[model samples]
Target: MQRLSENPNTLLALYRISQAASSANTPRDAYIVIIEELQRLYDPHAAAICLINPNTSLLEIDYALGYPPNLPELAIHPGKGISGRAAFNGEPILCNDVETDPRYVKLIEGVRSKIAAPMIAGGQIIGALNVDRDHVDGFTEDDLDNLVHIANEASRVLQSVWRKRQLVMQSSQLNALIEVGQSIVSKFEIQSLWQTVTEAAHQLTGAGLCTLQLYESKEKKVSLQTVFPENLEFLDMVGDIAVTESLAGSAIRTKRQVEFSNITTPDYRDLHDVPHDSEVTSCLSTPMIYEGKVIGIINVFTRERHRFANSERRLLQAFASLAAVAAQNAELYSRVFNSEERLRKSERLTTLGLLSAEIAHEIRNPLTVIKLLFSSLDLQYPESDPRNKDKQVIREKIDHLEEIVSKVLSFGKAPEGIFTHWDIDDLIADTCLLVRHKMGQLKIDLRHHASSRKARVNGNKGQLQQVLLNLIINATDAMPKGGILTITTKVEQIERRSVVALYIEDTGSGIPENLVARIFDSFLTGKAEGTGLGLSIVKRILRSHHGDISVTDTSEHGTTMRIELPFVR
Candidate 1:
């Protein structure tokens, strides 16, 4: 103790080791610094730095010098050997006669003297530093005190490094969890979702393998869905596990996280569906619960025996929750998509029927005139005259055509509805109110210009409202980046007839020149997801009420849809 306190060189060595250990980036770096300093100061025959494995509770040499090649792999139990005993007892040991000391376990060929000191921090012994000399009684009491001081400094620095590493790991895990949550929520494909869940869990937890399994309530079984690394043959080897058996089943039944330190041990080996693969040594399982019911299970496996930390276990539980939400979203999306498809089919059939009736109505007017005019051209000729026979055939053909038109009109007869006078301005205002929320969400600005006088028109209120609503929604869709929508209504006179005109315009990219001419044609669209039937249906509804719609003006600045109805007298 006098030599260690008086010698300036000894003080300098201690300061240098402390600096080196404190500045190290990792525990391994600190270990190397401590072992190198011990070798330089004492010139011992053998020196080693060992740490206790939290999972195994064994003192394993992390850094060594001058020892046999296989000595680093030696596992020393606490209280079993000189170094292990020092660590277990939390004290320093100086033995001059190794052959007489029953606690000494020979690691090197001819070591007779040994000194060991425990490295302690936070009131816990972490490991020990050991040194050996070839001759008995070679080390002094002063040497034992110096080694203990060096061990203490190393322990303090190493603990600091471990805390910093843990903080960094926590930050990284948080970022990974956020990314996984977003990815799982946006995607709905079952296979793709399963792949993402397994890969993310494996990478985030630093596990060797990850497996995802879903619970089937009717079957009372949990079946493996996906595995990370994709090439692992566990899919073929593993089968559906009953809800009553296995670690995964236990988690589902308990609705909590379950872990095993050494899954290869006899206690877990006999469990059904246990992964018996040699590479898998430890396992952590978390149940996927949604709405208080377990939907699935997530399991992460480690290649070496490890006790899962609290952080890792919590991260797995979070991942399981995200997986459950994703599965439920996928199911809902499927049902909605199927329902939308069926609705579209029904709408198409209804439109076809309406168009058939409209065509028949147009043909009946001209057919009636032709039939009446032909009968008036009666000629007084004999039955053998060819002209008379030709007239007879023409009359018969016209009658047959009239019968066909009547059948078509009857098949798609429009129902009679009450028609009342409505001010165009009030109608447009009500329609805009319905879509005000949508417009606000899209950042659109609506500007309505009512007429100076009431432009009243007689029409079915419901059908007219449908026309205005369709036009408003279409205008909004055109201005995807949120532009201005202007609606104006006024009374006008065209060819000496009074009419009410309503113009709906949008400040959007103009319709393509190729599409403008056929804008109201059925099944013609400018949008990727458009059905191409909205404008066509709107035009038909307007025509049925003695009104019409047309694209009055179109340019790069925008498009204007004009609707004209006869003014009520």
Candidate 2:
């Protein structure tokens, strides 16, 4: 220890090496600097830094100086050679007589003596620093001591650099995650959502190709849904994998990440679901878990044969979570829209029944008057006359008409509604939630303005919800691009009657002038796919509740629908 401190030149060399390693931006750069410094100070024929590869736990040369071209290709197992022995023991070795040492594994010819010292960081042996000479017994105890000090200093700087880089990379990954999450939420269509996730995984992992597979519990299989680049030619060759087979299947089964170091080998040839291409080498599969169940699998492939790091595994899993969220949101979107459609159909049927009943009652009174007049005008005629047969036919048809009217009246009778006092603002807010995702996906903004005074309405909750949904859906359709949807509620006096006025407005292309007058007329629609019953049913519901709806404003800028219902205190 005294000898190490006494040499001014040795101290200067160590200081320079430490500075070089510290100034490097990456671990690879620091490795090069440390190896070059070792060559300059010791003047050895060859100097190299061989670190333990996390994947193989072997001493593999990371940086070297003055070694053969093939030196980089060699990986020595721990406790096998001088450097390996140093790393294995976590100590320094001064092998002056190579011929006498049984542990030495010959690599470069004519190299007789070598010195190895383990590079320990955080109380663990990471690798070893090695310097070789061409003659036997060429290195001394003092040389070995200097080498050990240099190795320790290099290890400290290297570890600091590694940690800094890791932190920076992790920060980048986190920001990417935030962006990807936002993108995932904005994609309502399942295919677009799957494509977004696939591309994100590919970009984040830097993989050659990324594939997204969705798990179908009913089918008990995982099918390839989408792929990054969208141009991978081997898609036709890939097949659906059962939950019990393949790398992706294993991930789903275990709910854990599964890795294959090399998929080109004969053992993996039977994995029909994995893309078999020469350019593709390694594969990593992670399951997308949602609500404690596996929803799908995300598989990433690397072009070069490589072992994935712990950080990479964590990132892939994070992406899996994002993918799961996208899947969940898409499913929810489908369900909401489907439910809205079903409700619309139900409301249509109810309104149609009420209309039929009203028409039937109007015809029933006149038919009874006709029947009474005909009975009063009873006339007798000869049995052979055609007029007698005609009278009989008229009587028969009249009776048949009366019977048909009575049946229609019975079938069209309105069912008693479940009416209650409900806050208009709360109902509107709740209804908005159902279409919020759709609005977001279309880039539409929604603004709701609740009345300062409580605007309560006495009506069927389901009917009112149906009304709001109908108007909102129509507004969304009118805006094919994207715009703002505004909902406002206020209490006002109309013709001395207290009423609640609800306004649903959209910044969309307004209703055409030709259709404005009869927008509420059944089967009158401007839209290509419109059933034309939405607004008609809306009008019927409002009328039944003694309310009214009108187009208060319309232009190319937007449209406003005002629904006025009698206010209940």
Q: How far is candidate 1 from the true structure (C-alpha RMSD, Å)?
A: 9.1
Best by TM-score: 2
How do the residues 405-435 of candidate 2 rate in per-residue lDDT, one tens digit apiece? 8998888755548889999999998888778
Q: What lDDT does model 2 reach? A: 0.85
Q: Let me know the TM-score candidate 1 reaches against the reference structure.
A: 0.68
Task: List lDDT for all candidates, in order.
Answer: 0.83, 0.85
Error of 2 at 148 (Å): 1.0
- The segments of candidate 2 whose C-alpha lies over 4 angstroms from its true place after superposition are 175-183, 218-220, 227-242, 246-250, 258-283, 301-307, 336-379, 399-430, 441-443, 447-462, 474-536, 542-569
Worst 10 residues of 1 by lDDT: 334-343
